[model samples]
Target chain A: MALDQSVSRRRLLQLIGGASVAATAVGTLAACGGGGSGSSSSGGTLKVIGVGDQEAGLRKVLDAYKSSHSGFDFNLSFAPADQVQTALRTQLGGGNAPDVHVVYPGNGSAMSMAQLAKAGLLADLSSQSWTQKIPDGFKGAFQSDGKTYIFSPGSSMLGAIYNKKAFATAGVEPPTTWSELLSVCEKLKAKGIVPIALGAQTPWITQLIPYALVPGTVYAKTPDFDDKMLAGQASFAESGWVDAMNKYLELQKKGFFNDNPNGTTYEQATSMVATGKAAMAVQVSAVLSAFRAASQTPDDLSMFPFPATDVAADNWIPAGVVVGIAVSAKSKKSDQAKSFLDYCGQQENLNTWAEAVSCVPLYGDAKVDPALTLFLPALKANKAVPFMDQRWPNAEVQPTHFAVVQELLGGKTTVDAALKKMDEAYRKKA
Target chain B: MPAVLVYAVVVLYPSIAGAGSAFTDWSGIGNAKTFVGIDNFKQLAHDSQALGALRNTLLLTVAIVVVQNGIGLLLALGVHTGIKSRMALRLVFFAPVVVSPVIVSFLWKFVYNPAPDAGLNAALGAVGLGALRQDWLGNPSLALWSVAFTVIWQCAGYSMVIFLAGLEGVPAELHESAMVDGAGTVARFRHITWPLLAPAVTINVMLSTVGGLTLFTQIIAMTNGGPGYATDTLSTVLYKQAFVFGKFGYSTAVALVLAIFVAAVSFLQIGYLRSRETAA
Candidate 1:
């Protein structure tokens, strides 16, 4: 009987301990704006789709809007990033689209602005003042031929987010030149370290490395590379695409990347770098939060530009406007939808958003915290280039990128063949 | 009438809509639809992912139906010979089928865990079988088979039970007379028990073949049809394109192909199996 009582008491203690821990975690997230602050309003309801972790930040603005406007109310729902776009499409297809939403094209993301724009589902917020604040370079992510549709409140830039500790062991500063980067890889390999944690298993992730590296090539060529190519004035085979693939082949040839990259998935690659088994990763800026959690170092990982070439260095940035909020053009209350875009530009909302998602803001006037630092070298050299696969004329080009990467890593196709295949695929799209 | 209307509204209409939209670029919203003739189908035929998924799905179906039946028949023969703990054995065999596919996937995902520190690998290392350790989900060559094995392992017990039921209904006098004629267990199985177990075979093969075709949750929860289209089934590719990419129009076309493929293949298999049964 005593044993039973003691066991029960122990179990009770454990339950209380776990509950307290969970409460604290929830409290911390809530303090950051997870939820519970949206004020009640009486106006026709506005539905917002976002993440639960981001609810705290969203609620600050949502609650204020609801409270101040006695005539309107907003109902917010949270979904993981992968679920948002599909759910939006389904709801829209059924004629029940949400008032506002978040979007992720997902791995090898075939989701494009073209699909949204062509369908006329996305609203034209071309009239919004914030649109002008966007750089001439990044204006196309939200717009196709200079008309705005859906609004992305923020975006995640792709780059080499390196482990500082890994750099220290290799006795190399983060390489800023292509030659230095190769030397660094050789040095790391000599020390029994895998210089690059490449994952071809996801196929999409394999493409991210090349995509991140292509910004410099775009800069070397000019900002109008995509437009020229899309308009039939430029050819991919002529662009620094050949050079980019050559660099990738060089990395493979040097034994710089992990063995059997095709055998590794996105998670495995991330784990490799995070666990300090591998030195660096070429991925999106959005990976900071997840990378921090994975490595248990929410602070150590930092971003930088890939060391392409000197001429390319100045133009090597891939930036896309992401997660913009737009009112539906078909919406009955166009005025309300317009107001939401205005709200997105507000200082508190901007701060809440950038801080919440750990994203770099699109606007120059928007206040940025010094702690949310990214690759200053890369940012200075290259501005945000558009996400590569998104700019493809046909959706067919997107899946091609995923496949060629796998082929490259699998050793089934050489760099030349992959590029040739890409041209063939793109030409078909044309 | 209301129920019928609800079914039509909820299920039948969408299905027809999906099939109809396969030839068009509908994107999934609004009324504007563009008919592009066979562009989407041409894409599907060359869609490396879709084609790979179709091949993988068929591979899984073929492997599962064959292996699942083979194991079920073997179990039936053993269990029929009046064994102790027969009920306990039956319970153990049928246990996995009662668990949900999600749970089954999760359980075997842990078993197939590629990391050295994982449950299966650790056990193998412990048992001096470390040589057999594999990156089950990560290896392109092995992932599909690993996923197929998980599905087969889970459902094979149900197949066993069905066959056991068929075996019970078999006349014991015939088996005894065969034994009196000096016919061995293997020969008896080939001639007598196997011929009688046709109904069970038909049921198991048909069900398992369909189960393999529509496989989603386990693949989704496990390898996600990856290491690069390694284990992709038609369902996963359709899902990734429709849900993840919002290329619902393209995805619906893929779904049409899958529907047609499953229906046609099952129809053919049913005909072949039934003919074999009649011949027996």
Candidate 2:
């Protein structure tokens, strides 16, 4: 290395700065001309991405599609739910989005149908044969500007999953009222059993108790709570959410939860209920199989609608699409992708997909799984509401909700103070 | 021209593009971004979670720098003595450094399990010290410290290896003469060895400080910035803001602030330490 004594530090900085400026200019220009999906012009490999078990199920669907559709091949990929959103967004930004990608049914998600459709990243699927099969309520989740942009095969309900054996052992039935729930906790505690296996260490798990309680307390009285929230007429702090938060805190004060819930993971919480150490946990219906797998008698695990109000009829279960799929706007084989989605929408294919993943079928005529029969009464009465977070304005609110609830549970903040913080996050102008 | 183009494309372009977002209301989605002019930074100042993240980042960095370097120096000293098993001990201590931070965090997460009879609590309870067991990663006050301990645990051996290299650079004659002069062990280390180890100290401090400041994977894996915003650092908050919240402009402002802090701190620390380096 030769010494460049003539190059002063100031001059060196200038040179570096100039080089960076020139590089940025070229980089931006190059990014503008970034490659589109090369196979977009005609039949080729249709890249499909899904998260977790959705990917595995989609793989089976794709394998079927490949046999029936001769012109196009399919590439399948999977990521965890959060990472799937990240991967889709990154690819969408780079203009090489997957030909078919898993999307959330509605807004408040990163790859929400509303946002993707707004960005013109999803191909219109309004003309697909499957569009007629979608019921009116689900039509809004997959459509924007009166054009369908995504297809959801099924939905999942969020409720309390309990060990039937433990409940039987304690001589208590599933509680249908808030007071009954408290009494059941007392009975379980008296019997030396943990009433609920809470895993607040996981922020998602921390939000579950509040979510499960919010519908009956808030939505039952005000059915349009989330709509009001989106319209800025209601705030999380003021919309009976405080009552819901109070009920969650009440559970803690009454010592109904497991020891060191904040330290326990979602996996450990599942194990707790699976092994009959704890009686129950507030969880999504999707994880019922995981609980069953962890126990010798998988049949001992069953679910019930978690009641949040004293009036039994006021209780509502939260349910929504687990994941939906969208065709990339820039895809070359978009027709093939739509063809595959159409095949998925057929009653037989829908049943296969739903049964494979243990999700509730979306179509009216589709077969409902026996495992999910517990929620049919609530569903039949039309008492099930969409998840509160599904209609939230943006992703920031749920996380803030998670953190504040965790803090409340950890004794770091009061319910009012935590909800106040959530209000601040929710009110952040987009 | 090619060199300038490469630098512009790879380095200058992204920084400029990223900095541009710090001033606008971009959401990393559509191309439309309205210039907000310092609103993001303004929000950060009042944003309690952002402030908490900044405070936690500083605390984590300070804790990591002091503790990691101290333990590394101690380990180096221990292994440098005429112990026959020094090589094996060195390998054992350095093993964690080779493992990815994500894996290390996962492993330590199991170790810090909050269950009454699982992991750390189980061990604590087994020794008839059950009362000492607490939720390690779930309590707000303890989560930050617990994560910091895990970071230090993973990186201390890295610092030790650097110190050991610096120790080898010290000639035996200097220590022999100092011992011959009847100087105490502490005196010899303080007067002779400590001053000479300045280069290693600077390296270890710089590496640990940078690592601690940019800490993300471990926190995300171990606690995800919970049991309630207690363990969030700047990087994790930035990820959440940009990716989850879709606040690209605001997150860029956060990134810009973090970049400035890290650069200024590293520059100052390295400068001060370099000036302290003794000429052999």
DockQ of each: 0.26, 0.57
lDDT of each: 0.67, 0.79
**Native-referenced DockQ of model 1:** 0.26
- Looking at candidate 1 chain B, the ten consecutive residues that score lowest on lDDT are B240-249
What is the Cα-based lDDT of residue A300 in candidate 2? 90
Q: Which stretches in model 2 have alpha-carbon errors above 4 Å?
A: A1-45, A53-60, A66-74, B1-4, B278-280
> Residues B1-280, candidate 1, lDDT per residue (tens digit)?
9999999999999789768888887656556777988788888888766777888988998999999888877776777777898888888888998999998887887677666667678898999998987777666787889888888888889889899999988898998999999999889888998898888888888899888999998888776666656788999998877765546667888888888888997899899889988998
Worst 10 residues of 1 chain A by lDDT: A22-31
- Per-candidate TM-scores read 0.81, 0.90
Q: TM-score of predicted model 2?
A: 0.90
lDDT score, residue A203, model 2? Answer: 65
